[model samples]
Target: MYKNILAAVDGSSHGDAVVEAVASLAKLTGATVQVIHVRPSQVIGGAIASTVVPVEEREESQRVVDAAVARLRGDGVTADGEVDEGLREELAAILIERSEALGSDLIAVGPGHYSGISGLLHPSVSRGVAKISHVSVLLVRSES
Candidate 1:
């Protein structure tokens, strides 16, 4: 029944699988896919001194999105793409807002890198989004 899907991706090698899953789901439901990648913030803590993103980081982010789009197209699905700053950039809020702005029926997120203790101590954006989203969210675990 989903007509619009917010596919949240990290652009990791594992995350690519989530894109494929989203594409198949979109095909089945006749939904439009809104692909999003959050780059996290350029700074951490109160100061911007910790910024790690070089000027080329933006290009890298763009490349990630482009590659994802190409992958989807190869699968015969053309999805819209948007790249935002990640963790430091408040990816959680962006994901929530974009899903709403895009009128997405569901938000699909890839499983994160964290596992075991890390996953337990610091829930990822995906976990956070799943807890907070008003709409339904589908998680494609990394292994799957």
Candidate 2:
């Protein structure tokens, strides 16, 4: 049974699915939910590009978290949210850190891209989160 749940949202294609899944779980277990969206770090360009994310982008990340929290609340779940950013760490690391900070019992993640050459370039979110997190992780696969 989960007490506090941390749902990671990125406004991706599976964003809604993730919220819906987490809401169901939270409702069933009578647990509260905290949604978070990590602002993507700056991508280094050719040789040595700036590693800082734009201010607007960071604000947008917070908006994403707010929206997810709103959706969860609309589903009659007690939910709040926060925005996180990483200077050098990936999203998975950020999510795990936030979960620990919030004392979340479960970290819920949506489906990850696992096909084609692009998938090979980055590690899947679920795997990365599970590998680094101390608590349980729920990977809600996208409804095909």
Candidate 3:
């Protein structure tokens, strides 16, 4: 019953599962997908720094979004790409904001399967998004 889906991708290994989930959902519901990649912004002096992003970072972000959009479209689903900066906020907050702004009915996110000390240091974005999101959230976890 979803008309529009917002898929949050980071070009990680788990990202593929998120895309697959979104593509299948879109195909079943005849919905369009909007793939987004949010780059974490640097903080300076307790505030978000508005510094110019390096060319390499921008290109990588674009590449992630482009690949996601291509995959969704290749599945015969209408799809588009977006790149955003999470300034002084968590990635979850940005995704929620974009979903509301885009009027998306659902949000698909991957946990990325962080493990060991790294997982403890870095909290799960999908968990945060699912907790605070106004719209429905689909947590796509990697099987491996």
Candidate 4:
């Protein structure tokens, strides 16, 4: 019953399943879907080491998002994608902001690395967003 859905992703192997799950849900509900990738900001920048993601990362991100978009399109679903970079918490906030700006009704994210009780304590994107967002958030289990 959602009209607007935002799905955040990283190019992890788990992303394939997450995209599939999000696309399936969107298709079923006839909801518009937006795929997102947040490039991690450089926590420490120096000649020695930097947490900043390389520019090549965006190319890889595009590959992932393009594949996901094609899959959704193949299913006759409307989809779009965006790539941004910031801290993880900021990434989550960006997703929420975009969802609202785009008039999204729901946000979808995959389960965290933990399982069961630990997972709840960890509270992945879905859990965190649900608590923080003005819109509904869905937790999708990755088949990986």
Best by lDDT: 3
Candidate 3 lDDT, 1-144, residue by residue in tens: 999999999888788889999999999999999999987664445346445333238888899999999988889999999998865247788899899999999999987466899577566788888888888999888776
How many angstroms is residue 116 displaced in model 3 relative to the true structure, after the best TM-score fit? Answer: 4.1
Select the stronger candidate by TM-score from 1 and 3: 3
- Candidate 4, residue 13: CA error in Å? 4.0
* TM-scores for the candidates: 0.81, 0.85, 0.85, 0.78
Instruction: Assess candidate 4 and give its lDDT.
Output: 0.74
Each candidate: RMSD to true structure? 3.1, 2.5, 3.1, 4.3
Q: Count steric clashes of candidate 1.
A: 8
What lDDT is obtained when candidate 2 is compared to the true structure? 0.82
Model 3 misplacement above 4 A: 44-56, 87-89
Off by over 4 Å in 2: 46-50, 54-56, 87-89
Cα deviation at 122, candidate 4, in Å, is 10
lDDT comparison, 2 vs 3, better candidate: 3
Which tens-of-lDDT digit does each residue in 21-135 have in candidate 2? 9999989999999998776664555666545654347668877888899889999999998877764347788888889989999999986765899587656777889998999
Off by over 4 Å in 4: 45-56, 114-124
User: How many residue pairs collide in each prediction?
Assistant: 8, 0, 0, 0
Candidate 4, residue 126: lDDT: 58
Higher-TM-score candidate of 1 and 4: 1
Candidate 1 vs candidate 2, TM-score winner: 2
- For residues 66-115, write the lDDT of model 4, one tens digit per residue: 88778877888899888766664465677788888999988877656667
